[model samples]
Target: MKPASTMRPVRTAEAATTSLFHRLFPVNRDIAIKSIFGVWGAYFVFVTSRFLYVAQGNVDALFVQRILMTSICITSTWLLYRLLIAVRGRGMKSAIFMLTLPTVVLANYIAILDQIVFDHEAVVFDFSYLLKAVDFASFDWAYVLDEAFTRYFIFAGWGALYLALSHSQDAQRMMAHSRQLERVNRESELRALRYQLNPHFVFNALNSVSSLIIDRQNQQAEKMVDDLADYMRAVLTGGAQDMITVEQEIAQQVRYLEIERMRFPERLRYSVDIDQATKDWSIPSLIIQPLIENAIKFGVSGSDQPINITISAQSEGDRMRISVANDGRVIEPTARADDRSTGTGTGLTNVQDRLRTLYGQNASLLLANSKDGMATATIILPDPSQIFQDI
Candidate 1:
């Protein structure tokens, strides 16, 4: 089981950053653009006021200040877009590099073009004029790089925040799934256990044992008692667990079936075919025995034809499939409920429930009546090794 407290740090960081970005910026692109426009508009008003104070009524310098502020706003908007992609997958370094380089070249070009080429009076700006206006002392290339780096540093911090938030949400979802699966597993085990202790079944088996004693078969009757004891012990002890190996459960079933064979020596015949590869596979305990019992009771006994029950196991991909078929009449709606009820309907019901619990609707107990008077009940369970590895 994964620890409740531990989490992947990268995933955690990404989730937090993603969530924070959504909360702060929201999804409405028009609204976001409008909000940015409003902020820049206000900044322009504040800058105009400052320029007026400094020039003391000179309108030309105020015009230049307005142009500088507008250029800064456009450059900032472009950088913000690049920062968004960086938050998605690109780390801090990529975000900063991409955002800064383009914005710096563009911003500097806009400033130089303003003073040199577009001087309002058509004053031509030559190489020397643009070079002198570069102002190495204050507006040097190093200074521009430093400013761009600082702006992107803030953007990187926001990206980290969103990343953390994304991971937390994913962890929360997995935790919920784990809890649900655990509950379903418990229900499957409980239902499997409950069906194992069918009252009518015990009563019938005991009655059969008594008949053996009445016929003066004292030795056989004692053996029946011993077999019943072992079957009950396995059912009781193994029922608590969710699953047991196919090999172990089948061994118990063989013992139980041998006891049943004693009751109908000539009437009942049984055969089992299991692939060697699937013997050690796992399945919900006691799943097959009930089907076999049903076959013997409904198909073989009291009918003119001798009952031949066949149990087979196979594997498909990561799952193990098994089928139990018996030579019996197809159960019709008009068939007496009392006759059918003699065996454990509880067992069949439990098998279906366990299948649903473990694999939701994908796993199932399938029943079909063949043309040759063969009734088959097929059970498909997830392979335990594969299931364990997946979890």
Candidate 2:
């Protein structure tokens, strides 16, 4: 699963990128249906107008016949649309075979309609008189054959056009979604980077565990060891999955902060005020880890007083607002513009990029000093009800 999941996108993206036609006419069913209606509707109007102008008021019968003929053609071709949808994703050979049968039926339908409505020069020699003993008026074999010979091409052409639109739209959408998932996977790989895997931090944790065991605080040492193991496992598991519930995310963060608390028990304090309503909401896994990491690394490192970090999730209108705020540092908004001032700016940028990739304009990440003088990074994303249905 890991090898295929990790490498399949590289091949799929490469194939999908070569499709310039799909890019220009992206996959949209509504647009495709509108174009079909627009073209057929225009053809109907043009034929009716031509009959009216050429014959004037003397040929009202011809105008009515033209409407009937256009209606038959439109109905037959709409059946083709339904057929195309039913046989979609079959290979071109199968699709073409499926389409050819309907075009033959459509041509026959139109040819029969012509026999009923109009008396053309061809009707005189339209196999009706040749086979006087048979019902040639109802089934003009020659005229039907002639219509099939000429008008079969039109339905065939429409079939091919529909196929192109169907497959192109699927390909283009698949490509877009595949690229976003690949981006998500790449970001997830950075989950265990920086201070989480720093050698000094690992050493400090081990030494602290050993000191607790030496002082016969075996329960504290055991709990710290468990927390350390659980935290690493949680963050490292980010690669394969992109989304989890808000409740699950907060649980993982709690493990992480518990481990950190062992490291700076007196200096670092944290709390979670997640709304009960938001526990079921979907969020990108480890999406909030960056904010927490930044708060601890910058906020805890720079401050002498005990820094209180608060993580909160609130339901605000049509969005779910989540924030990680710390009272230690009041970050100047302009300071973020200088990459050097914020050390490794990877955390904030990673959160921002993930938000954009996952939710586009519907999601946002902001870093600023709050009214209480706490440095906060707030993420605003679509409410679960709105976004989850599509997912």
Q: What's the CA RMSD for each of the models?
A: 14.8, 13.7
lDDT of 1: 0.65
Q: Which segments of candidate 1 are over 4 A away from where they belong?
A: 1-181, 184-195, 332-345, 385-391
- Quickly count the clashes in candidate 2: 1
Winning model by TM-score: 1
Models 1 onward score TM values of 0.53, 0.52
Best by lDDT: 2
Query: Model 2: what TM-score?
Result: 0.52
The residue pairs in collision within model 2 are 27-169
Instruction: Write the residue-wise lDDT of candidate 1 on 44-95 in tens digits.
Output: 6776677545744436644564555465654565356545544545665665
Alpha carbon deviation, residue 344, candidate 1 (Å)? 8.7
Q: How close is candidate 1 to the true structure, as a TM-score?
A: 0.53
Task: Go through the candidates in order and give the clash count of each.
Answer: 22, 1
